[model samples]
Target: MNAVGVIVEYNPFHNGHAFHLHVAKEQANADIVIAAMSGNFLQRGEPALVSKWKRTEMALKAGADIVFELPYIFATQQADSFASGAVSILEAAGCNSLCFGSESGNIDSFYQTIGFLKNNNELFQQKVKYHIAQGNSYPRATALAFHDLTPNEDMLDLSKPNNILGYQYILSVQKQQASINVFTVSRKNADYHDAYFSSETIASATSIRKALFSENGDIFSVRQYMPETSYNSLLEYKEEYGHFHDWEQYFPLLKFRLVQTTPAQLKNIYEVEEGLENRLISTALESYTFKQFMEKLKTKRYTWTRLQRACVHILTNTTKNEMDRKVEKASYLRLLGMTTKGRVYLNKHKSQLSLPLISKLSLQQNEQIMLDIRASRIYALGTRKNQQRLLEMEFKQPPLILN
Candidate 1:
């Protein structure tokens, strides 16, 4: 049961995702393709366009042999932790290779950058500090320092979203000293930040999401970039759950949580650093809308995404102490969905799995899983769909086993 692992957040399973899956299989030449996907909430610090279960079904229907939940704590962090968590799950699941999409599309280039960073650890750190002193954001400072130190154009490209995550995936693999072979498929069509659809067969998830949630959005316009199965599933989900969500919808909850909690208490939330708790506390009172609050809180030192993640943590009452206390590695591989082949592979390799394989949520009882449940409950609340907002949906829903 040789398998290739992919870390994904098919927020809405678009054609580009389907293409990535196909390429991963071809590149790894593996019998199975397993995806460790984000559940409910996403890395961008927002609720997913659809539920994790629907995304899993889309993936399984398209090509994935198995889909595992990447756990909430790991799924919504910065790239380094996110990659580490995903890699840990795949490694534990006995995946022999890891495949990802990258802007550069060159695996050797990523390795080259990794080698330079690893070899010049001290110099890189010094340069990063120097850049920070010069008022660059941490991500910007790191990228600039890497380029200044290595003079590799590709290394500089690590600033891009996909490349940054891809670089982190390689770093995570090296950090684990795992034997997973790495591969990359070049991203196609629209860029990561592109906000509109321009092609019939390819579109960025960002673009697709923007179209889905925009007030004037025509869902049919974005449907051309999704497979029939995915698009149809999305349509059904929309019919049942209303429309996809934006963080703004949860503004009241986020604002209420922030306003009620003191700065000292806000400081306890994960990712609340550099006196950000004070800023959040102050800004939360003055700003009436989520957009205004984000604007007031955002700083050059603290990225918008980082602030959003912090707000989500605050909203969910995810304390830094709790995350710090939880084991860094993924404790379990929670199954979201699977194909027939995936079931067979799981049965054959059950004993070989490094972590507990959880097909049912009830099988695992831990703080981390509880956090995931909390996230799902919050996501359910934001759905704005009367019948579909049940928290029990997370418990009652079983893995979508596709034939």
Candidate 2:
């Protein structure tokens, strides 16, 4: 079977996601669609609004044939690493093509931008360093450097969040020399960070999430922005867990981690550096909530997302050494859910897969995947479910096999 891939978060699996999934398969003209969905956390350094299990169920019901968990290490990082891990998982799953939503839907533009960056890597790096030295954040610095090299709007815009990830997806494809051809579906109606509902049906995940939280998990407020399957999934998750996951939910635990660990010990957490330990600890102690703590911690040099990612590392006690030990590629394809088509594909290709296909959590013990287990445990604290039940959900539950 010809397979296509999508890298997704599906924080709540809104209509925009459903649209992307539908278009991706049509564009790729593949028999089955596979998704490398982020686990409990997301690339934006925020806890998922729901568990990965419900998100996987949403994906399968929406259009995805299979759902694979993008492990914690890659799922919560910035675009480049996130794209790398997603691409690796897709490749391992035997996808012949990849389709991603982007502001610039032109695939040629991505190749052009990547080729230009590669050719002028030295100059680009120098400019990035200069901008960073000038107090610009790393993401801002990279965008500035890209614009410095290409002053014209002739290439894909790296400043747009989806386009940036799309660019990184193409880069990861080239870097790994994978066999997957990539296509793009231009995002419609809303921007990546739009905080308000801009359309009747299409809304950004950010907007959906913001609305969900602002209304105190009232699924009806954002009902129009999601498919029925997704809408019901949101309802089901809320009914079971009593609350959606978010940074604020885990603030107490984060504060506990912050207050107990010394600055020296805090420095060991990934993304904690440049005396960020002192800032995090001091600010965490003074501020009562995650929002207040982040507000106090924000600086010109560090983005909100960057600080949250650092906090995620701290909350998980993920050390820099732990991440540094992870190799460039994903070691296993952690199946979360699948339809009948996906099962057939997997059964046929199981013997030829590049990475191990792990469905049952009981039989696997890779060190990198230990982070995923640890992350799920940490994620449970953000919800109202019994911690033991959630942990057991991680270990005892089998992959959701949809018919």
Candidate 3:
């Protein structure tokens, strides 16, 4: 079967995402659509308002043929690593193409930019260093350098999340020499970070998340935009728990873990560079809330989300060495959900797969997997029921269809 791949967070599967999936299938003439999705934590360094399993189900019901977990280590990382991890997983799963939403929506321009950057690596590096020396943040510096090289004013607006991730996706595909065809669908209506929602067919996931956290927890407000399966899942989760919001309840445990760990140990955590460990250790002890601690550590060089992710990595004991070791391309596909056609394709290609396909959550001995397991346990500290459920989480059977 011909398949197209998507790398997504689907923090809460919304109408815009549904549109993208439909376009991906139509544009690629694909028989199957696979997604490499973030788990409980998202790239923005926040816990998902709803569970990953529910999101996977929503994706499957919304037209995705298969869904695979993107893993904790990669999910909470920067753009480059996140794209690399997601793309690597999709390639391993036998996908022949990839489709993503882009603000520019001009594949020719994207290719031109990628080609320019590839050919002028030394000049670009020098220009970036020059900008950084002027005290600009890394993103700003890199954007300035890129603009200087290509004189493309539009690409300089790397502040947008999708644009930044899209560039990284192109870069990864080029570097890996992957044969997967690339395609983009123009981003619709709401901006990625915009918290406002409209009655239009396209709505940002951010807006949906905000609505979910509102006092009434009104699913009806955004019900029209979400897939029926996703809306039902949200309602079900809310009915089970008072509200499907608030990750702050886990902050106390996070703080306790931060305080208990030594500075030397904190030094080992991913992104804990250049004495940031000492700052984190000191601030974590004095600040009463996670937000306050993060605020205290925030700088132009280190973004709020980056700092938050670093703290999470520290709390979860994801060391720099551990991240470096797992930096190699993904070696396995951990299936989360799939349709009948997806299962058939997998059955046909299973033995021909270059990487292992994982469906069972057996005890893994690798350091990275062990750390992820421990982090999953820690992530459950917010609620008693969740704690029990997490500990007993089983490897779901294949073809776990939503409907």
Candidate with best TM-score: 2
Off by over 4 Å in 2: 215-217
- Model 2 poorest 10 in a row by lDDT: 321-330
lDDT of each: 0.86, 0.89, 0.78
Instruction: TM-score for candidate 2, please give it.
Output: 0.98
Model 1 residue runs over 4 Å out of place are: 153-156, 325-327, 386-389
How would you encode candidate 2's per-residue C-alpha lDDT over 1-403 as one tens digit per residue? 9999999998888888888888888878889999999999888888898899999999999999999999998998888889999999999999999999999989888887877888899999999999999999999999999888865576878889999999989889999999999999989888899998888999988888888888465679888898898898888888787878889999999999999999999988999989999999899889988889988999999999999899889999999988873456798999999999999999999998999898888535887789999999889887776666777888888999999
Listed in order, each prediction's TM-score against the native is: 0.96, 0.98, 0.92
Deviation of model 1 at 231, angstroms? 0.9
Per-residue lDDT of 203-261 in model 1, one digit per residue for the tens? 99888888776778888878789999999998888888777778888888998998899
Question: What is candidate 1's local distance difference test score?
Answer: 0.86
**For candidate 3, what's the RMSD?**
2.3
Tens digits of per-residue lDDT, candidate 3, 1-403, equal 8999999988788888989999999999999999999877778778777667777888888899889888777788888989988888888888899999988777776776776777899999999999988877777888888777755543424556787888889888877878889988888887888787765666888888777767775779888878888889888776654456444666787788778888888788888888888888788788887668777878887777778788677667777877873484775677788888888878888987777887776675455456556666666555544547644553333436543
Clashes of 2: 0
Clash counts for the predictions, in order: 0, 0, 0
